[model samples]
Target: MHGLAKNHLKKILSTCSANRDCEYYPCHYNNQSCLWCYCPFYPCEDEVLGEFVKRKDGTLIWSCMKCNWIHKPDIAAEILREITELTLDKTTECSIDYLENRELLMQIKNKIEKKLGKSNAI
Candidate 1:
């Protein structure tokens, strides 16, 4: 391939590259890792959902990028609904000190979206 063509290909590869957030040996950052290639949850490519996540029970759930239509393992999610129904008798103060992880999540979503667009899946 010509030098300019090679450079252009590299730009495309950056967004298409697969990465492993898990601490696995010999990650495929170079050319081996097969990360999230497409919207894994939604069935139809036209309505590609954002991604799939594993619940504490190891069940998979697909969440919409635009909406909150989480699906899959309907039975598993029922536990969550039940939990929400129950409440403590007494009021108690609670807080969550979580750092902003939106950027990281967005980066992964944008990369996946860009790759899907390149393949003309939309």
Candidate 2:
């Protein structure tokens, strides 16, 4: 938690809401958390979780539509917690950096891998 204010952490955590009314509700799973409508780790280019798809224009883009690792409520909460702990500045109450923190990114990848196991089940 570092020195992050309790209220601020709570505020961040509160954003992890499940919107069931949306047309694309349950986009990944029966009870997936809609915390990230768009993944924070887009273009990760991780073969285990995603891959490059060739579009009609022959442009390659990373596609993670089948990856549901982050949709799990617990996983989403943990990721949010880790990100806040790593990026939030206690004094300024601002997020100084996010993806630039290699350690944090690695931690997230390792957690995803551990959960996915050898099969990489969607």
Candidate 3:
């Protein structure tokens, strides 16, 4: 895996050590965890998982504060596995633009679905 990807995977695998410090520590949801404090695949084209929010400065941001799909250990692990196989040579940006990488996103989604044994993306 590339250095950036590998580092991301490591962070996902590590459970949140500061969960207790957060006001909303444990969300009442199955498999929910704080592993994905910052989603690598932020602004993913999963409308069901997130929506665009306009901040006071008029900057559009993908808000997924209520989404916990990536927090599941199994899902995170599966995503990391797929990420390890990617040849991300075109970009070095921390956040991936869904429209710009539809093919890669589809592949990762397929792998994730297969890993979870379900077609539901999430």
What lDDT does each candidate get? 0.36, 0.69, 0.62
Report how far residue 69 has shifted in candidate 3, in Å. Answer: 0.7
Which should have the higher TM-score, number 1 or number 3? 3
- Which predicted model would earn the best TM-score? 2
What are the TM-scores, per candidate, against the unseen true structure?
Answer: 0.19, 0.67, 0.53
Model 3: which residue pairs collide?
none
> Candidate 1 residues 3-97, lDDT tens each?
99999877645433333333541232233323223332233223443457678999976644432222222311332233233323323332111
Query: For candidate 3, which ten residues in a row score worst on lDDT?
Result: 90-99
lDDT of 3 by residue, 1-122 (tens): 89999997666444643255456666525435566667666667566666888999999888876566776667766776666556354354533443247677776766686668432243
Q: Which ranking of candidates, highest lDDT first?
A: 2, 3, 1
RMSD of 3: 7.2
The per-residue C-alpha lDDT of model 2 at residue 71 equals: 76
The predicted structure with the larger TM-score, 1 or 2, is 2
Q: lDDT tens string, model 2, 76-104?
A: 77777767676666433445344656666
